[model samples]
Target: MRRILYAIAGTLSLITGLIGVVLPVLPTTPFLLLSAWCFARSNKRLHAWLINHKYFGPAINDWEKHKGIKASNKKRAYVLIVLSFSISIYVVPLTWVKVLLLFMCIALLWNMKRIKTL
Candidate 1:
């Protein structure tokens, strides 16, 4: 029962990670790490495959060892965050939601700055 739950969670995380690849507003690293953890608990084969994955594996390893994201990735993130927040703010009619989005943007920018650049 627990294993099934973990497998489901892992699958969901993997799907989110894949989406993050194209959607700059979504961060991929944390979701991929969560996927790795869930896979390890539920399925050994999947855990091994994820950690050994070519492109993602290295980024996972780098994050595990160095707690870092590439400078290029960070640059792109800055651009996307601004673009996304700007568009959303303009489209949303509610003042409270716009304020919340502004706060979220500030928090995200703070987090990105704090992360070590590789």
Candidate 2:
């Protein structure tokens, strides 16, 4: 039951992370990290595959080894977050939603700032 739950969580996190590639509101790295952790607990093969993935592998490996993200990746993430949030805030009609997005943007920026840069 525990393993099954972990597998399910891993699959869901992996999907979300993939979607995050196109959706700036959804973070990619954290979800990928979650998937890696859940897969490591549930399925070795899946974990290994994720760790070896061309695009996602390096980030995971860096986090695992150094507990930090590269400065280049961090800069890219900051740019995307700012650009997307700016567009979304401008295009959104609902003031409340815009405010919520603003908060979310700040929180994400804060969290990213808290993470060590390699």
Number of the predicted model whose TM-score against the real structure is largest: 2
| C-alpha lDDT (0 to 100) for residue 116 of candidate 1 | 97
Q: Which residue pairs clash within candidate 1?
A: none
For residues 77-117, write the lDDT of model 2, one tens digit per residue.
Answer: 89998899999999999999999999999998999999999
Measured on C-alpha atoms, candidate 2 has an lDDT of: 0.95
Residue 106 in candidate 2, Cα distance off native in Å? 1.7
Query: What TM-score does candidate 1 reach?
Result: 0.77
Worst 10 residues of 1 by lDDT: 58-67
Mind giving the per-residue lDDT tens digits that candidate 1 earns over 1-118? 9999999999999999989989866878789998988998999899888888987897776676788988887898788888999998889999999999999999989999999999
Query: Considering only N, C-alpha and C atoms within 3 Å, which residue pairs clash in candidate 2?
Result: none
> Which stretches in model 2 have alpha-carbon errors above 4 Å?
none
Q: Which stretches of candidate 1 lie over 4 Å from their true place?
A: 1-4, 21-27
